[model samples]
Target chain A: MQERLGKWLLSWPPLAYLVVFFLLPSLIMMFAAFRYPGDYGGLMPLTSEDPATGKLVLDITLDNWRDYLTLESFVRLVDEPLYIELFIKSLWYATLTTLICIAMGYPLAWLIARSPKKYRDLMLLLVILPFWSNFLIRIYAWMILLGPQSALSKAINLVVTAFGHEPVSLLFTPFAVIVCLVYVHLPFMVLPLYANLEKHDMALLDAAQDLGASAWQRFWKITWPLSLPGVYAGAALVFIPALGMFAVPDIIGGTEGIMIGNLIKQQFLETRDWPFGAVLSIMLTGGVLLMAGLAAAVGRGKQKAKQKHG
Target chain B: MAKRQSWWLWAAAALAYVFLYLPLVIVVVYSFNDSKLNAEWVGFTLDWYHKLFNNREMLVAARNSMVIGVVSALAATFFGALAGIAMHRYKLRLLPFLVLTPIAIPEILMGVSLLIFFVLLNVTLGMTSIILAHVAFCIGFVAIVVRARMQGMDNSLVEAARDLGATPWQAFRLVTLPQIMPGILAGGLMAFTLSIDDFVITFFTAGVGSSTLPLQIYSMIKIAVTPEVNAISTLLMVLTLCLIVLVSKVSPGALRAE
Candidate 1:
């Protein structure tokens, strides 16, 4: 009995802490998503003002919920071509960033995994060390590098001038935003891929070679299949956060590269429309969750197939 | 174990490292640049560093961040260690997911939700609220690190203590506690760095007259990229690097465990 009580005591602190701070806040946001916006910023009463008190009384209604659930927001999103364009633009940027990260990260992860044991830790540290700095400062560094007056842009301009073309202004462009996003999330891709590749058995490849399989065949039939999970994990890591990223776009994207995250920020801080912001928040959360669920399902399916084959 | 040396792969890795370090090098180098504007290559000087020290708002923001980081790290470590041990020792179905939700969710969502939560609760947003928010997210990180450490520990040692008539509390205090001390310290250090570096959540939850270093840096950068901002960024980066080094030295396995 005492031991059981002690176990409960040990578990309850974090559980309660999370409930009060983390879970409760998320639940509140979910509830707020279903309520009407007040005149200024916060949620409003569902009913009209009381005549005796001349004050708005607190009540529950699905009016706010219905506004979103009935596709009102979706219609608004459709009606506004800018929002749809931004959504597609954000997806395009995120997809390009993920692709670039994979191109750069896969080889790096492989090299690190294949490196001698003593140097492995140092290599991994190098990958993570840049992330120690403030994210804003890192993006600022990119701004300096890509600025028109900076040496890099000047040098590029020289080449373009010699070629009878216009000077390159890289700052405040979608290309700049994509570059910084890839830089910011490259480590996220590398870490998971490294973790996955480090434990892979090379003997399987040797066995395949001994069985008269070509190198490409061995990789296709063995290595690629094995690394799919890591690829999916890395993709998810890079994709989800990249989709909702605001700071990079806000700093470097200018008006051309504004994403849904910036729109959500505008609603909450700029427009002070908490209900609309809550609606966008719910949509983002739902989308992220759905993507994660799909990835997990695919991963599980691959796992089962591998098990059956083995 | 001799394998073919892939020069192309090594070159690619080298280039990747360059990409990662280029911006960091720029920040550090520009901190000493004599020019106020970041455009020109002026002679080297320490004026920015000097200004960084004399700036009142910057110092106060740094102090606020330090206080919040330390307090939240300590609080998160305590709760995280308890929960980590509990999860390792007990079989709870939903506990792991609960811990992971904060980490997996987007920071904007967490920030906005917490802001709403504080408003609904009628709690003033300031150092206390920021610390609470930090602790809420930091707990998951600490829990993950500490739990990874505990997973590799010998279960028989705790069981033997119990068999020798040690009370549950005593077993935890004398046996299990000492074993996971390094993990707790590592987790605490990580939490501290994370709190100091956090911006989005802190941006939303920070009330009037409560600017942290990241907030100060953001405002400064938004206006212009001055050498003073570079100085502060260099300082913050050095501080985080030192803490990470300390964490690695304290628990070499902690990084790999994550």
Candidate 2:
């Protein structure tokens, strides 16, 4: 009995912590999403709703869900030219950023991974060192660089002037936002790629070369294929956060660039349209989940084929 | 050894590093600029930093953000360490799967859901609410770091401690804690950094009166661009970069060195 009591006490810390803070609060929030608001825009208790209220006053109606799921809302979202454009723009930005990260990260990861054992640890630390800074600060710094009177802009203008061209406007646009996002999230892409790439054996590359395979052929056949898993993981890592990014776009996007996350923020904060905002949030989340599911499925299929071949 | 084409790879990496650090370099330089435009090459001046220190609201906001960051980091590390221990020692039903869901969920959803939750519970949004939100997100990061450390740790040490007539608590305190202290410290730093950097969720849930530094910066930037902002931003960037370097120097696998 004393032993059982000791075990229970030992378990109490984590269990009590999560249950009180995480589980309870999350459950309450999930439930809050269901109920209707009463006077003063407060949520009425779920069990105390009227049954036969046709006037839709102080009653439980599936109104929020209906408002979200209706064809009109769908059509309204779909018909809006900006929504689809922003959605597509978001996809392209995320995809392009992921690719760039891979292109840049793979070789660096390779170099660091295959470096002399003594310096390899130091190299890896340097690569990840930039991430410790606040993410917002980094993005904010980009604004200073790309702004009209900033150092980067001034330097570029001088170079262009030497080449006999007018100073070009580069800041406060989609290009600026993409550049900032890619720079900010590059560490996320690199770390995972590095982790996986470090696992590949050096003997395989040597074996391929010993078999008289060309350098390009050996890379395409051996190195690239093996590192594809990391590439996929890296892509997912960059793409997921990039898709839902807001602060970067809001800061750097200025006029020409805006993403779906910005729209969601506007709905919630500026517009005060809670129902519509909730619907948008649900849709955006659903879209991301679907994309992630599809990516996972593709990854699984490729892994299965690799397993079969091996 | 098979030598591959390394030129392109080297160029790409060099370019990438330059791209990553250029903005940071610019921020550091512009912080001392005499000109307010942040574009022109003005002579060095510490006036902005002087103004930043003297400003009452700015000082208050910085203090508030620091307080929140310290509290949230400690809370997150405490809870996260407990969770990691639970996960390591026991095979609790549904705990692993449930914990992983927060990582997969969109940040905005978490933000909105928490907003609704607090509204329903009639809890006022303020410093405590912001701290609570920060801890929720930060715990996942701390748990992941601590769990990784736990994985490499030997269970025999705990067994040996217990066999010597130590309580479970004593065994953990003397045996396990020392082994994973680096990871725990690294995780705590991560929590501190993440909590300080957060904006989206905090923006949604922060009370009317409680203004964090990020929230403060966001509002300032939205209205107009100022050299004061450039100065503030530059300071922030340097501080963050320094923190990252410090953290990396302490932990073996904390930062990927290049």
Candidate 3:
């Protein structure tokens, strides 16, 4: 009985705190999506005081509920193609970033995993150190590097001009956005891929090699197939955060590149349309949840197939 | 086992490291540049560092971040250690969900929803709310670290303490607490760095005059980012790097445990 009481004492504080803070707020955001935008910056009131009773009453009526709340936010999202296009563009950027992270991080993760044990820790630290630095600072570094007068920009523009083309600015283009996104998310990819790659049995590779398999075949047959779980984990880590990213585009994307995150920010702060913001947030949340569910199902199916084969 | 690595892998990995380090190297280097252009190096100077120290608003933001970092770390470590203990001991479904969801979700979701929730509750959007918001997310990280530490510990010691006529509290006080102290300390440092480095959540939740260092850096981006911004960023990076090293020292495998 005493130990059971101790267990309850240990659990309830975090459980209650999270229920109030994390879970409740998410539920509220979902609820806010169905409400109407206020004339100012809040949601329209769904309740009011009754003069006679001096008590609160539900202002939303069956006849006049439309006055208080509506589905306008979702309607607006569908009615206009602009938001859809922005979401699509964000998806493309995230997809490209994930693919790039895989291409770049694969070699680095492999190298670190295959390194001498004494140096492995140092190498992994070097990879994640820049990531631990301030996020704004990292983007700000790019802002300077990609600025028109910076050496990189000047060199690229010089080449373009020599080729009889107009000078191109790198700072505010889609290229800059993708570059920053990949830079920000590269560590997420490397860490998981390394964790997965580190556990591979080298004897399997040696056997494949002794059987006259080329390095490419050895990698494709052994390493690649085994690394699928890592790839999935890394891809999820990079893709979700990249999908909703606003800061990269806000600072360096210029006029050309904007995503769903920029729109969500606008609705809450700039536009002061809470319901629309809630709606956009709900769509984003739903999309993320759906993709996550799909991935889990696919992963489970693969697990089942492997178990059956065994 | 003879490890065979190809030449292309070495070149690719070297280039990857360059990509990771170059921007930071430039940021640190250009802070000392004499020119305001941030374009090319004319000559090195300490003027940016001097100017950064003299900037009052920047100092106030730094102080605020320090206070927030310390307070939230304490609060998060206390609660997170409890949660971690519960997770290790009990067959908990809800506890893990609550603890881990905040870490997995996109940060902006937390930022916006907290904004709405605070406004709805009529709470002022300021340091307290920001701390509340931070602790919500931070609990997950601290819990994960502590739980990972707990996983490696042997059960016999605790059981032996209990069987030796010590009460449950005495057993916990003497045996378990000493073992987990390093984990608690490491979790505290992680929470401190995360609260200090946080920007997205802070952006939505901050009101007038409650600017943090990251918010101050961001506000500068709208106007202009001079070398002064670079100076503070360089300092913040060094500070966080130190804290991370301390964490690694306290618990060598803490970073990879999660």
Candidate 4:
């Protein structure tokens, strides 16, 4: 009993903090997703103050709940094609960002993983240092570069103009959104990939070379296969943040570049539709969880097949 | 032959580094440029810096950010160290899930949910709500670091101390804490950085007249392309850079923790 008490004592502060702050808030949001929006802004109160006792009473009725509380938001989420389109576009942008991160991150991770031990820490630090700055500042940096008067824009437009094409505006486009997303998420990809690559054995490569396997062939047969776990890890780290991203799209994403996160933000702050906002948040969370579950299942299946083959 | 085989790999990595650093270099360099366009080299001036220092709203926002960062970091560190120790020792299943979910959920979900929560509880929304939200998220990061530091530690040493009649507090102080102190310190630094740099959650929970630096920067970015924003961004960059160097020096292992 004393030991148990000690355990409880050690664990309760954070456990209680999370229960009050994190878990309860989440359960509230999930519950509120089906409830009616308040006439002013937030959720409609489920309780009412009784004048006789001056106490808050549990006044949610079967009639009220069935008619209004549970109908509007979920129905709107399904009935509106705009929300579905926004959701799919966000997923697309996130998936594209993950792919770009992989393409760019692979070479950097490999180089650092193969670098001399004395310089490895410095290289890794260099990769992470840029990420530590307020990410808005980083996005702002992209804004300056992609703006109309910047050299990169001028150069690209110069080529287009020479070819008898109109000058292309870059900022506030989906292109700008994707670039910022890749920039923000690249460090996440590089770190995990480096960790996995660092542990790879060189003997297999040397032996493969001795057998007259070309570098490309050797990489495809050994290094690439060995790095799948890291790639998956990196992909996951990139995708979730990218999927839920709003700030990138909000600042750089123009009329055409808005995503589901933008809509969710609008519902809460601009539109004052808390129920719809809650609904959007639940959908995004549920979709991510569903994808994660599917990925885990596939991973398990792969492991089982490998075990059987071996 | 060795050189010939690896040039392309080296080239790709070099390009990636340039891509990573060049935009930031432009931002820093332009802060010194004396042009409204923020594109051309038209001599240098400290005009924006002067303007930023005089901006009362910017000063208040910076002060708010500093206060929130320190308090939330302290609360998060204390709670996180406990969570970390308990998790490592007790194999607490529920704690890990609670710790990790905040890290995994999108910032917007957490933002809206907490906003709803504060409204429901009639908690006055401002610095207190922002700090509560920050600590809630930062505990996860600090806990992860502390847990990482606890891994590979000499548990037997603590057990031996206990066997030699040391009290739980004494065993912890002498054997366990010193082992994990670096982790705890590093975790605290990380929590501070995360809190100060957070924008999305702060946006939702910050009531009227209570703006943090990132929220300030966001509003500025949305409205105007002022060099004042550049000046503040440069200052923020330098501060975060210092913190990174400090974290590396204090606990080099923590750099490798994540």
lDDT of 2 by residue, B95-198 (tens): 55445555656576677767766765678998988898888877767777777778889999889988999987788789999998877787788788778878
lDDT of 3 by residue, A1-310 (tens): 9978998999999999999998999999998988987767788877778999999898887898777767888899999998889888888998999999999999999999999988999999998888889999999999988988789999999899999999998988999999999999999999999999999999999899899999999999999988888888888888888987888898889879877888899999999898889988887777677667766777788789889999
Docking class of predicted structure 2: acceptable
Candidate 1: CAPRI quality band: medium
User: Candidate 3: deviation at residue A262, Å?
Assistant: 0.7
lDDT of each: 0.85, 0.73, 0.90, 0.90
Arranged by DockQ with the best first, the candidates are 3, 4, 1, 2
Off by over 4 Å in 2: A1-58, A61-85, A150-168, B1-5, B245-250, B255-258
**What is the per-residue lDDT of model 4 for residues B1-258, given as tens digits with 9 covering 90 to 100?**
122338888999999999899989988888988988868789899998999999999999999999999999999999999998888889788898998888876788899999999989999999999999999999988888898888869789999999999988788899999998988999999999999999999988999878999999999999977788889999999999888778877777686676
Writing each residue's lDDT as its tens digit, candidate 4 over A1-310 gives 7568769988999999999999999999898888888888887888889999999997777766664467679899899898998999999998999999999999999889888888888999889889899989999999999999899999999999999999999999999999999999899999999999999998889999999999999999999988887888788888887898889999998988888889999999999899999999998998778666765676677678878999
Sequence-dependent TM-score of model 2: 0.86
**Which residue runs does candidate 4 get wrong by more than 4 Å?**
A61-64, B1-5
Pairs of residues clashing in candidate 3: none
In Å, residue B64's CA in model 4 sits off its true spot by 0.4
lDDT of 2: 0.73
The recovered share of true contacts, given per candidate in order, is 0.70, 0.42, 0.76, 0.74
Sorting all predicted structures by TM-score, with the top scorer first, yields 3, 4, 1, 2
Quote the positional error of residue A223 for candidate 1 in Å.
2.3
Task: Determine the C-alpha RMSD for candidate 2 after optimal superposition of all C-alphas.
Answer: 4.5
* TM-score of decoy 3: 0.97
- Which candidate, 2 or 4, has the higher lDDT? 4
TM-score of 4: 0.97
State which candidate has the highest DockQ.
Answer: 3
